[model samples]
Every structure is written in C-alpha cells, then in structure tokens.
Target: MTKGRRRTTRDADHESFDTAYDAIMARWPDGTESLTVPTPYGPTRVHACGPRGAPPLVLLPGGGATSAGWYALAAELSKTHRVFAVDLVGDAGHSAPDPQRPVRSVGDLTAWLDALLDGLSIGLPSGPPVDLCGHSYGAWIALHYALHAPTRVRRTVLLDPTGCFAGFRASYLLRALPMLLRPSARRVRRFLEWETAGGAPLDPALLRLQERAAVLPAVRPVTGPRPDPAALRGLRCPVLLLLAGDGRAHDPHRVAARASAVLPEVTATVLPGVSHHVLPYAMHADVHGRTAAFLGPLSRPSR
Candidate 1:
C-alpha cells in the first residue's frame, strides 16, 4: 500500500472511523480472530473466539454499535462456546453490502443471516444448533431468526430487546428522530446520554466510534410489523430476556409480562438502574452470569 497518494474525504473519514472502531475492539480477549465470510448480500465480517469444538454462539449487536461493541459479552461467552460476533450487513462496521442485492425487507435480512451462518459453518448439516444472543435491534434480529429457523437455534438471549414483546415508547422515538433523520455527532451523544440517563458510563472508545458513525452513510434498516404473538408462542427454543429497569424504549414491565405470557419458554428479568442503550456493555458481570446460566453447558464437544 502506498501512503503518499492524496485520499478522498470519504476515504479519510472511513480510515478515521476504522481507527476508532479498532480502539474499542482492543478490549476483546486475547487471540480473537477477525474473519470475513462471503454471503450473497455481502461479505460479512465476524469477530470470533473460543475453542473450535465448543458449541457455537452467534452474537448480534445493536444498530450502529457494530460487532466490536460485544467485546465484554463475547469474552465471557467464549469461555463456554465458540462465539462469533457479527458486523451486520448494511449497518455500521466493516461489513459491506452489495448494492445490487440490498437488504430491503425483514425476509432479506433473515436470508442474509442464513447465508452468513452457512458461510460460518453453523447450523443445519454443517454443525449443531447455535446459541443466539442479541441486544436491542440486534435482539429483534436474533428473535426473528430463531423463529425463522427454530431447528437451527438451540437457545436465545435478548438484552433489552425492542419490538419483540412491546413497541417503542413515543418519547423514545421522538428523542431518536433527529439522530435518525439528520445525524450529527452532537445528536448521537445527546440521544445516548438521554437514554442511558446516568447509568454506568458507556465505554469512551465505543462512544467515540458511535459519534464518528453518525455521519456515515447507512442503508435504511429493514423494519416491519412485530412478530405475531402466536408465532412467539410456537417458538420452541428457550429464551432469556434481560430488560433494563430504567429503559425508556418501552415499558419494561409490560415487555416482561407480555413476553412471559406469549413465549412458551422464557425467563424475563429486569436489571434495576440500567437504561436501554447502555445495557449491553454496562452491566457486564450480571449479563454474563445470567446468560451463561441460561444457555447452560455446551451440549457436546465440537466435532
């Protein structure tokens, strides 16, 4: 690579963004390997750790947080499973989307995950059912995917999932609109600060990356009607739903009650004092301990 050539502004911005992203990823456990797997929608980037033969656990991060945001959670899960934290296509992070085959619908997003799992050699004939974990928007993806392919997912963990058991609060959406419609670093910081509401402080590196990503071009996230309550009842895989007591996204108690009633097998717990956006990284020890206990020991040694 030559360093003397003048770079375009977009190129420089991407480089700077990558630098900020890497700074946060530095917290990942030792020997974490970055892998790029080809999918029809795009080449997916995954941060993987854990033993080769352990049960596979796929992690999906919230919108804009990227796979790097799961460093803390991934480290703990890696102890018992072969953890693969994915950089969702069409979102922030190293994953690139092929404009020709954009993810335009929830179905397309699920198909992308199908291809990604195949590329990663997880699920179906290639390997055993995976343990899926997600946060916020990522949790929605995880839940949808579990419903989309129940046979392939052994268990699921959702951290303050939005749009699963309840809808977002009107106030939360109003606060987020400015950041969504016309993003700026200031808006990003303000939205997070407001949502986190003085909970445990967010990681400085991840916060910097979020601010940098605010202005980056992003494909509109695929959105649709929430999964039907009947469908939720039919999902056979056990689920662990962790809610934030102070979360303003939706009424956590309502979410818990609805989820407990609708989900055939679910354990819903609300962590007091935490807020929505910060739940993933804020309550590290509690999240890890609860998640590990729910997923249980690996089923069998990886073959």
Candidate 2:
C-alpha cells in the first residue's frame, strides 16, 4: 500500500509539471492576437499583422529583440503576405519557457523553433508553407529551422546575419564598457554619433526607444553556436541574403560569398554605405521593394 501511494504521488508530480508548463506557455500579453500552439519543447507566442487568409511570412528578430522589432518590416510585408513575427523563446520579449530541460546547443535551438512552429500551427496541410525572414541571430535560427524542417519552409531571407562573418562578432564590452564608464547624456550622445557615423540623424524619440530597450531586465549575454558549413551546404530552399556593405564589424561581400557558396540556391545583395543598425532604416524602402518583387513571382498560388 505504501508503494502504491508513492506511485500516485509521483504521477501527481508529473501532472504538476505538465500543468506548470501549460500555464507558462499560455501566459502572453493580453489583447494581442496570440496563439498558444504546443511544440515538442513548449508553447510559443505568434503575433500577426495583415489578413489571415493571405500567404504567411514569418519574421524572426535579432537577439534580445521582441516581435515588435519587426514592426516596420511587417507593416511593409503585410500588404501582400500575412506577416507573423515570433519572439524567440527563452530570450527577451514574450515567449514561453523552453520545454527542453537545459536549452543549450544548436540541436536544442532547432528543436525549440520546431516546437514553436508546431505550437503556432504555422505550417500544415491547410496553411501555406512559411516564407521566413530573419535578422542577425534570428537569421541563424531561420537557417537552422530550414535545415531541420525543409518541407515547412518555402523561402528564406537572412538580413545582416551574424554567424556568417567571422569579423562581425558583437562584443558586450563594446556596448557595455562605455555605458559603465560614462552614463551621462553627453557620453551617450557621443556614443550615438560614433555608432551612426554622423549619417542620418536619429529622431530623439527613436533614440529614447533604443535606450529603453538597452535597459530591459531580460536583456543579457547570449552565446551562439558556431555555424555549421555542412548543414548550410545541405539547405535546399531558395535563399536571399542581404548585408550592409558599410557595417562596422562585418564584411558584407565576404560574408555573402561564404553564404552563397554553401546554400544550394542563393542570391546575395550588399547595400552600400549602411551599418548594421541603420540597415533597417537606410535600406528599408529599397529592401522592401526588392523583397516584394522577389517573393511575388515565387510565392505559392493562393488556394
């Protein structure tokens, strides 16, 4: 009888885990159009814009960026495609706790994304295969997802991807060391000027937004796995890789060549005189127009 009671308690504990996982998955910002889809890992949040009936394009933001990061891109893409920007789980923004015990390694990241897509009902018999666009670390996620779930991905665009270039390493010290030493407005202004290279001036409000984002509690160090050349070579989907030619750390031409050499089908473009941060703003209109043209002829026919 004691053994039986212990077995019952164990079952109860397992049930508790399931319940907590479910609750965490379901917790998302209220009033936003959200879907809680179950993945192998955990539930994921999918935020959308544009008509539901249109073809789907998934947007993956850079590290520490939430789904809101793709606001401008989504607004532009939504004219033709149903845009869904996903907040990567276990990172900043609104995403459920990872289902896997200890979310480390490239395989784990791929599995987490697979679970996210499953949870969101992203690709299925009724829905169109996804067209994915990812920026920076998000690009790495998109690339792995395509490799793991090729059938579910129709086309992929990697915007200012991080792992492709050895030189483009983003250092915490580069951003943090200065802030720690000089938190004054003058220092911040100087930093901003240096960061932007006195190019187009950023709106004061936009600068404030960047500042607030920097201070978010969830923003922390992220260690990324090295790129797998073999895996990249194996990808069969159509790919578009965009790089900013004038990015401080990344060499756009070299990175583009490396990506093009590995990906089976690829087109690489470099926007001259643009930095990593300014790419979205400087090349926004052009990229949007070009992307629309690229996807228009290729996207699956409406049912």
Candidate 3:
C-alpha cells in the first residue's frame, strides 16, 4: 500500500453495508428515529430509541462494531433511559469514514463527541447531564469523555474497557501479529471467528467494517494509559465497572481491585464465564437490570 494511497471500499462492501443495515433496523423498537449529527470532520449517525423526553443516555460500541452492535440489548436499555446509540465515526457504521484524517488524538475524539451531544441537545443546558456507557474500545472512549468533559457526563458505565486498567494480552498480540503484517480477507474472517466463537456471527455490515479497519494504514484514535488512578480519583460521578470473567483482553479481577482502591465512588461486577466479545448482549436482562439499578431513573432539570 502506498503512503499517499487511500483505501476505498469496493462494490462488495456496499452490498455488505446494505444487508447489515436492514437486519439491524429490524431489531430496533418500532419507531426509532435516526439522526445525523454533523461534526468538523463529517457527520455521525445516532439511533434514538425509547421516549424522546426521557433522560438522554449514550451507548458506544467496541472498535470495529457498528451502531447495531447493541441492537440485541438496546431494547432493555431503552426501557428506562432514552438510549442514543452512536455509530462512531471512522468505523464501519453509516457515518463517514475519513481515513486520510483518522482521529489520532483523544482531544479530537472528545471534541467530535462534544459536537455530537451539542447537536442532539443531550446535556445540562438542554435537559440533564447525559449518562454514558461503553464497551471494550468504547468503554475507554466513555471514560475519557467523563474525565475531560466532566460537566457533560453524569453516571458512567465501563464494560471490559480495553487498555484502561490493563493492556492487551501478549497472546492476543502474537496471534494478531500476522494479520497486522499481511491483512487479508481470510485472515480477517478467521480473527473475527476467534474473537466471537461462542457468540453469534456479526452482522455483515460490521464484518465488512472490521475487514476495512484491519487493512487501514492509519490507526483510529484510542485511549492510551488513561483514566489512570489520578484521573479516576478526580471524577465526581459514580462509575460502574463490569468485568468479563476469564477475559483475555484484560484481567477483569485485577482491574476491579484497582478501580475499587483508586476511585472514590465506583462499583464492580464480574460475570462468570463471559469473555471480552460476549457482552451485555449475552445476558441482556441481567445487564439491563444492573445498569438500571446503578443509574436509577433519569431526572430532567426544571425549567
């Protein structure tokens, strides 16, 4: 691949996106309103479910995951909170992809989200402080937002956040090293299967999205050794950390212990036998109940 050369999606990619979009939309509640929030780089797509007047809550999926990654579980989430599921930019969702200017810094990602919330009127000025939840890569993103933009966030939920408390396993790096050096369709499929072995097959759109992400020359902006103990200590809002038992991405138990010690207001839960990829989707009702209990009900500000 040439340095200046950009990777454009072929026709097959379009087909995959179309197929996944239909499947994803079918899973959403009957009248989900889709909105496009404009950003400096481009537009981001947000899928709103539940009552419009309900407390605004944002849901962010893991890296290479589309907005619908939360489809199987969004229903339960929307029951108590107005869920604003986001199709993060630079990923395979309907949002625009700017490979030439990949979000490389945390500030860039934060500002992108700031514009999104402002566009949706999802915070104190408009209503109430937004509640944020993220899984895997998204958990790291959510944590960053809470730390840097404290005023905008209320309660936060981090589920098996990658790179926050612990780094990726050496085994994962070793297994993925070959794909990094020479990414191919077959390798991508194999990696996906490995990550989601017990779970169901990913929607075609997300599969295609991950395929493109695997070969991208530039890296997406990600959370580094962030939300460190110092940052965690400063957070005024409560944080819920859900750990996946026997997780390979990070040591869940270790993270739970560390977070408990450093954060003033934090709760930790470890789900037995669950892995990194198998998240709230695997136990929708259980996760939903816990999330609702932790967050309680939304309280809009008075006029």
Each prediction's TM-score versus the true structure: 0.95, 0.74, 0.86
Q: What is the C-alpha local distance difference test score of each model?
A: 0.88, 0.65, 0.75
Which residue pairs clash in candidate 1?
Answer: 53-302
Per-residue alpha-carbon lDDT of candidate 1 for residues 1-303, written as tens digits (9 for 90 to 100)? 378977787887788899999998899899999999999998999999999989899999998889998888888888889999999998999999999999988899899999998888888666688999999999999999999988889899999998787889999999999999899889999998888876767677888899989878998988888888899999878889999988889999999999999999899998887888788777456787899888786455332
Per TM-score, what order, best first?
1, 3, 2
**Model 3 Cα shift for residue 63 (angstroms):** 0.8
On TM-score, the stronger of 1 and 2 is 1
For candidate 2, the lDDT comes to 0.65
- Candidate 3 residues lying further than 4 Å off, grouped into runs, are 1-9, 97-102, 196-219, 298-303
Determine the backbone clash count of candidate 1.
1
Model 2 lDDT tens row, 185-205:
455555555656744445343
The number of clashing residue pairs in each candidate reads 1, 3, 0
